[model samples]
Target chain A: MSHIHIDIRKKTYPARDGSGEHLAIRDLHFELAAGEFVCLVGPSGCGKTTLLNLIAGLDRHFEGSIRADEGAATLRIAYMFQNPRLLPWRTVRENIQLALPKGEGREWVDHLLEVMGLTASQNQYPQRLSLGMSRRVALVRAFAIRPSLLLMDEPLVSVDAPTARRIRQLLVRVWQERPHSVLFVTHDLREAIALADRLIFLSAPPTALLHEVTVDIPRGEREDETAVEAFRRRLIGEHQQIRDLL
Target chain B: MRSLLYHPISSFLLFLAFWQGLAVILASPALPAPQAVFQVLYQEIRSGNLPFHLGVTLARLAVSFVLAMSLGTAIGIFLGRHEKLDRFFDHWLVIFLNVPALVTVILCYVWFGLGEIAAIAAVVVNKLPNVVVILREGARTLDRDLLEMAEAYRFGRLKTLLHVIWPQLFPFLIGAARTGIALIWKIILLVELLGRSNGMGYQLHLFFQMFDVAGILAYTIAFVAVIQSIEALVLKPLDVRAKRWRR
Candidate 1:
């Protein structure tokens, strides 16, 4: 069964200077299956973040409906934005604890902090943390609730290469253990190939899905950067639209 | 501990020496020696007069400070969140902010008939606008990204306010509070001097009538000591705790 179904016929923003409306997304319809890892690859300004916002219920003015298997109201959703977005005044542990539902235990928070190798720094504030460490705290916060559907908007972008790789590995490890449907948005094709079971390509604004590619390699083998790069090159060569859009 | 205490203590001694030297040079009744002021302060304390007046003034300050802060914070947040309400009330805030404390006190007494309610209301009227202005700026500058995070995580209203909104507003609240306490106590004194039968302000007025400079100095010293202690004991600790999360 699909974990969540998103059918946004149109989404638009009014021009600030009294001009006509600017179309953001048109005819973007897709369903995320339970436990499936899907990466949305799109060009910059393609409204990927806006689409995620729609699904996360942050921006509810878009057209059409998003239905989950458990009904929209009951389905738990967690979002990780591009920036760390951790509360600076809150300690790392307190930040994660804030995300948990009432009556939930702190054990899950401790376990996630341990998985992220942030157990020692959990009492420290976000301002004292390096960007990589803060991002790890943000990831721990996202997983603290064990949401049924997780939406990430280029969460690993702009990090140093080694830290980004380490974060991706931690992300995959946690996702494997928790087993949830994830809609990951990224501009990096190689990163998506390494992380996603299926890659959905999107065009520039008034964004619509252009193509879908399935990574045939086994999950364990995807850890090899050379193999992921080779697969990305082959996929780009095969799909002229993917090459043009990217 | 020594480093922290040494400078302030030495500075205070330096101030006393200067005052003593100036008193000896001038040798006027209007400018009494620090020792003479201390003697008067001791006498008032011994007779129970200083404590009673100080307690009464402090009670008025507490009531007015709390009322202004709570009311101003709620109104400020409401106005900040709603552009239309802010626009509507902007002129009123400006008028109240600029009106003199003395005018408000006299008006409250004239209108409400020289009662405790009038004195406190006068102080609240004078201090509320400042708190509102401070907290309005705070509410306006709240982080949008964190608010979105709260919404995505389903924090709900109360949780969002406590964990997310409150921390962001804390610095502003502190700003409002520090200024509020300072402003409220001064206005309370003015209100008491204008109409009330008792309090440090009324006693100061009585001393002024008799040209009892030593008595005025003693009362002023006592009040300043109390205010400084509050800042040292209550506000400084709060500020340190708030900034503990910062690098």
Candidate 2:
């Protein structure tokens, strides 16, 4: 498990053609304790992905100090991109194997295949699998590393509702088994509420943290449809701005 | 096996019939009957001269092809990944690509003297540019998403290249290899003809001086048959193995 501390004084992207600049983030700050599940919710095009990129160390143009406390081993961060970036040339099992730490065995990959409901499709190439199946493989690949921090960038955005729900449940199941610090970005408030222990909401572009909502509902009570509906309703009623963004 | 034999055998017979018809029509030494050329082919094979010359040509082709392809792919990948380097070296690729094979052979012969090194060097220089151009496009178009995935997962450099980068680059490498062999073998003949006293091209040159059209045709047919066998046996099988992942 890893605790991530993010402090951004300001971050501005220069204009490509020498016009004005784009203020992607300004004075935004947040932190995550070890094994905490946090969901970042924001309006569309509000630099949610940019924030994840900064935390994941993919984008360094930002003026920020993002630190992850090193545990026994150096921190291993696995990112599940918005797209299911499985290599088309590799099989599902091989794709997961690509993310295994050095000297890690194939038994973990077999277990991941079982967990992802991909036993039959383990030998299949990415081109032949459905998008949901591909996403599951990507998730399996991410978790196979037994990461200290996992950054998910709208992983279920383009899937249908049923598949998205199933994948979300699969994600929760895997996380519960081996808890890791997770920062999931999503524009869907319902998804954010359903998945995260704590929800941090952000405003439009030049994003600054608006609010942090802790889910009081227990883990066992979370899967009930009526309970989720009640919690979502209460959340929207309490945060009118979140309802407005929705 | 029957299906495979049917088309090629039928095509071979059809070609022979056309050749026989032309021989009968022309009734000239320039155009010998297919059977007459085959007779010379059989005699040369039995005498071992044809096989020896063919083996020499094959050896030269192998060395030059290996040199050209390895150098070309390395340079192409280097240029493709580095945009500034690509810009600096783009004009050089153009120059080498446009230079004629015959001219290159003659220049090598003039500069390095009439030797095996000159002949092989000419063949390599002529073929290298084409491989470079093809692989440059391959390297340029490598998927950024997959690369980011590799980095995020902390894949080591060798693993990333083998499991991620090499698979993406395989099709381009295959393309370069196929065309390199086709173009380089023909150029090797010119190199051998101009400089070397051995190989199929040199033998063909000797037959030309004697005005022996049947001997020339026999050598040509033998060389072509060897190339076709390599394509069918080696290249096609390798292509299928590399691309088996594709649906």
Candidate 3:
């Protein structure tokens, strides 16, 4: 089972005002085996989100090329945004069903909604949901797709601390159930620590890859102490070094 | 429940009292008392022509409103789906929104030669832009994550729209429809007055020409009552039902 190899080399977007080019990704390169979980952390305005968009083929205007070696576009890629971004009018279940492949969508929608603890609120709309609940709905919506690649962009930014922990657990469980490559982007160092198998630290503006640290902390362990201490000393050092650059 | 009904009426009665009090102080007949207006309204009802005129006006308003709503919604959905198209037609919406309804009605009359189509067209032209703007804004704010999820799952375009986009846009569309109906009715009446021979606006003009203050007040009261009934019986219930998803 070969994995997706996204060779992103020298991507840039000309600044909107045309004064200068906003170099979003400069000479970026990365490869993930089929089931590896990757987390990308960066400073504010470091353009990790933009890079995610480019990789997803949502944005085609860039200086460089992205060659996807393994999965076809039909292999499917689920993306979760900073905000849950649930459709306000659709019931949470309907929102998930809307993401499923026609006839096969309903059962998965039901199952995933249950998995996300949204079965009770299945009939409720996005506006009626709390922040954590909304993000969970977003999670179920993304996870239900059975994507070859799961791309997450700071999806839990607004949830409470305790809720965030629970969500992190759910994410890991889903990852275990269907071992897909996940490109998780976050600003939270603790979050990048808790979830990622491979952590990539992105540099400040005119974003470029800085450090690639492989966290060997065993999964299914206590997320707080187990994940943190395993790579804490080295990860913290790299985190602070990148922090000073911004 | 009783207080809710009484509050607005009492407020209106108080306003009328102030106007009547000023009328008494100035000793003028130009501004009639509320009772006088009510009396005039009663007299118009007794005259037996009120119902026929009211019926005609209501019919005109219905046709105009429906035309404006469906067309505006269709155009809005298209504009919302296509950003390039939205930009191209955005200036047209600005022009329509700013143009006075009366001036637009006049132009319709000039172009269409005083037929019922002119009246209907005038109301539609005035009402369409408002609905379009509301729907376009709704379309722009649609959640992209949900859409990306839909794409990833490989839902057909029909399923995505039916289950995803339509459900999301329904509340916005319904609210726009409700408010647009309220606006379209008044504009339609104006169009009826300037161009069409029958309808509330035309009847109001007729009463004015004949110095029949009671008749004018009767029609005004009738239209106001109809609007309130529509709000209470139709739009309010629809809104409650639609917003249940949000709840």
Candidate 4:
């Protein structure tokens, strides 16, 4: 099945403080296919989040259109944010339950709990979990409902190095089997290269898509670090070039 | 031993001893010592009128406090969910917050014709706005990402409130309740003084009319003791419960 075409010909947000205006994104035309992992790479202040918000329908001011061809108008969309954003009041399992359609069975929640390695901590709330564990819970919360499109906004940035790699691996496995499209946003170029099939690089502030690069890597848990190293170097190279310009 | 234990009783005993020593050095029998006060308290208790009147006063105080807390929390939650509603009520809230409890109680008596309803109304009005302001600020200061996450997963408004909004609001509610509970007891006494019969404040007024300082002290002690019990038993549990969401 084909994923949606986001022909966001232009997107603009009016400046709240009357500082002229804010151009979050402009003329962004992209088509994502089913089972494709697309990453948006940008500087820290770039509008990757705004573009993700547009796709999520959390905001609707974009000039163009995004049409999902595969699902009905009510199909669920999952999102993982930079902060994990789990409710501190809710237990780890309950946060996943929030994603499910009402009256859905507990079995699906149980499965995700097991897969996310949160079974032991299922009764604990978000504040009790480490940053990496909370991020795992956040990932499971997004994937629990089997969304039509999963949107991730720098989901692993808060975790330590070893845990970030593990989470990156977990995300890839879920992406490989997601049965939907993923629009991943990150400022980390290496993260984009590691998980994305195609990477869209967004420049600073009033962000514009500078370039899109395609990555070809097979799936598996082979612990070879060379490709990851090479991808990191390439993204770092791009990062330096973008940094100089911005 | 647990978090709720109060340490001021021993300090209070020491303070009383120091007062007694000062009175002894000054050789003044006019200032009753702590021992004399305790003797008076024991004689009043043995006569059984103390417990009866104390229970009546405590019951009135409890009714007033419970009414204030439940109604205050409801008003607080309502103000929290509606921004324009909060703005419209802002001046009204400030008006009530700044009004002296004695003046508010007298006004309630005049307006509502000096009844139990007037007394409860006074307590409720006195306590409500602080809770509203506290929870309004709590709701306003809510983490933006948690809200976005709720929408992202498509949680319904009811679920969002119960799971997301309420937990964040609870700590503030507890804080408001702590302060409100304190304010509540004092306001209830004033309400009882201005309108009601058979309460600690009414007895205090009676003692004042007779110029009976010991009777006045006894009634004040009874009311303070009741408020202290509620604090140690009730509000402390709520405080712990609210903070439980953090870890």
Candidate 5:
């Protein structure tokens, strides 16, 4: 059965200065098959975040319906914002644990900390962590619930390129253990290519669906230098705008 | 003890020396020497009057402080979260905030007729608006992103409030508490001064009428000492603990 289904007809927000309504996303429709990793790529200010928010049910004012194949009440959704959004007052472990349902044991949490290389920093507060470390913690928290649906909004946008690459690898490793339906939002074409099973492109503000690309390459081969180069060249050959972005 | 006393002792000695010099220069009964004031203080303590009045004043401070803080926080959060409620009562908050504390005390005394309830009610009324104002700002500036995160995760109401909301609002709570305690202490003293049978302010009022300068000085010094200790011991430790997360 399809795990997640989103069929948004229209989503418009009032202008900030009390002007008039601005169309954020309209006629947007998509679905995520179980265990599929779908990336939503678009230009900056393309309302990718808004679209993700609508799917996550964070913004209900928007027109259109988003339904989980499993009823909304039974479906568990985990969201990772562009910002780490850790509770500053809580320790790293506490922040992660807060995401878990009550009375759950420490084994999974300890395992996640070890896997994310966050064991030493578990007792430290969010402010004490570097950007890379904070993002890792946020990822752990998002996955802590072992959620059926995971929503990521450019979760690795800010770090230095090298750190971002490593974190992305760590992300793939974590998700591999339990493949869940993911709808990730990003503007980086390379990242969307590297991680997503399928990519959905949206046009700039007053966003509309533009294109969809599927990566048939096996998961393990995606990390190889040559494979990434081939995918990059193919995307460049096909999508001129995505090439300009890179 | 030695380390703690080193700085405070030097400061206290310097203050005493300055007071002694001023008393000598003025050479009036109104300005007693520190030695004379301490002598009166020692006598009052030995006779047990100082402790009794101080105890009464402290009890009032405790009751009023708790009442104002609890009620203020609830109302502040309610007003801040609900726009219509805020619009309805925001003007009332402004009026209450602007009203002179003395007027509140006088009115409380007149309305309730010089009882414990009146004195405590006056102090609570005086401090409540300020607490509400602070917590209201805290509620207003609440991190919407974090709230969305909590909502997405389906956090229970208790978990959301304790783990997400309270931690974010903690600094504001501390701000309100610190200011509330200081303000309530002063207002409680005034309430006692206007109409009360026993308390530091009542004793001070009696001494003022009789021109017993040393007695007044003794009471003032005792109250100041207690307040200073509370600031140093209670509030300072709390501030440090609450802000351990901050670098």
Candidate 6:
């Protein structure tokens, strides 16, 4: 069954100058299965972040409907942006705590910090942390609230390769421990294949769904670099459209 | 070498030495020696006049500062967020900012009749525009990304304000406060001198008429000392605490 349904009929940006309205997304529709990991893969500037924003309910100007099967009002959603977007003045621990609903305990926060190997730097400000550490804190913040759905927008895009690998591993481990539905947006097809149970590809702006591919490999074998690359090669070789787009 | 020379104590002592030297050269009552001024300052304090007037002036400063800060911050945030309202009142703010403090003081006393309310109102009017401008700039530059983060995380109005909005506005608020305190106190003194019957300014006025330069110097020194202590004991500590998160 679908955990969330997104039917974006149209979304547009009004002209700032005297130009004209620019269509961003049109005739896009998709559903995320319960506890499924879905990666939205697209070319650069394909309104992927805009789509995430629309689903997260940050922008209400679009003509569309995004509903969670659990009931939209009661649904808890956590979003991890492209940047850390942490409150620089707050400590890592406090930044995570800001995500918790009222009267919730700090034990979950402590547990996540320990799991992410950020317990030692919990009290330190974001400025003191490396980019990798800040990303982990952002992840911890997203998970602290234990949202029913998590939306991530290229969260590991700019990190160094080693750090990205570590973060990706930690992310998979955390998601495995507490299986929440996630709609992860990334431009990297290889990264998508490595992490996603299902991959949703998109066309360029006025972006729409181009194709969807289910990763056939089990979660255990998908982590192996050789296996992930081989699967990516096979998938691209078979699909002429995805090969062209990627 | 520069650090030692510019140490606050050493710099202060150098200032005193220069004053003493100038006093000896001029030998005028207007520029009394530091020791002579301190003697007068002691007598004034012992007589209880200095403390009483200082307290009265400080009380006025406190009232006006609080009023201006709260009112200005609210209005600043409002204008900064609403481009239309800001544009409408932009000229008004400029006019108020450019109006002389002396004119405001005279107008308030003439309209409100030489009362405490008039004195404080004058000070508030003189300082309010500055606070509003600083905080408006702060409100304008608020981070849209962080705001979106707050919204996505379900940070309702109050939490968004306390966590996301307030921290971003803090440096601006601090800037407003520091400049506000300095500007308000000076305006308060002018208001007191022009209208009120009691305050450091009134005493200074009396000293001016009698050519009691020593008394003037003494009162000035005592007031300066109090302001310095406040900066050291209150504002500096607050600043340090706020900046603890930064490297």
Q: Write the residue-wise lDDT of candidate 1 on A43-144 in tens digits.
A: 998999999999998999988899988787777888999998998888998888888877585888888888899999998988889999999999999988
Q: Which stretches of candidate 2 lie over 4 Å from their true place?
A: A71-73, B1-6
Docking class of 6: high
Query: How well does model 2 score by local distance difference test?
Result: 0.89
lDDT of 1 by residue, B193-235 (tens): 8898899999999999999999999999999899888888988
Ranking by DockQ: 1, 6, 5, 2, 4, 3
For the predicted complex of model 6, DockQ is 0.88
lDDT of 5 by residue, B1-247 (tens): 6777679778888889999999999999989999899999999999999999999999998899999999999998888888898999999999999999999999999999999999999999999999999998889989998898888888879999998888777788888988887788889889989999999989999999999999998998899889878878988788888889997
Pairs that collide in candidate 6 are: none
DockQ (C-alpha) of model 2?
0.79
> Candidate 4 — which residues are off by over 4 angstroms?
A16-20, A71-74, A101-105, A203-213, A220-246, B1-9, B15-52, B74-92, B245-247
Give the Cα error of residue B147 in candidate 3, in Å: 6.2
Instruction: List candidate 6 stretches off by more than 4 Å.
Output: A103-105, B1-6
Task: Give the number of the best model, judged by DockQ.
Answer: 1
Q: What lDDT does candidate 1 reach at residue A229?
A: 86
Candidate 3 local distance difference test against the native? 0.79
Interface RMSD of candidate number 3: 2.9
Q: Which lDDT tens digits does candidate 6 get at residues A1-246?
A: 238889999999986785999999999999988889999999999999999999999999998899888689877889999999999899988899988877685888889999999999999999999999999999999999987889999999889999998999999999999898999999988889989999999999999999999998888987788999999899889999899998
Over the stretch B46-165, how does candidate 4's per-residue lDDT look in tens digits?
998678777876676667667776777777777777889988888988998898888888888999987888888888888877877887788777777888778777787998788778
Q: Candidate 5: where is the Cα deviation over 4 Å?
A: A17-19, A239-246, B1-8
Candidate 1 wrongly placed segments (more than 4 Å): B1-6
Please provide, for model 5 over A1-246, each residue's C-alpha lDDT reduced to its tens digit, 9 standing for 90 to 100: 247778888888888999999888888888888888999988889898888787777789877788877787767788999999888888999998888887684788888899999999999999989999999999999888888888999999978998998888988988888888888898887788789999888888778877788987788887776887788689879898666644
lDDT of 1 at A165: 94
Give the interface-residue alpha carbon RMSD of model 1. Answer: 0.6
lDDT (Cα, 0-100) at B13 in candidate 3 = 78
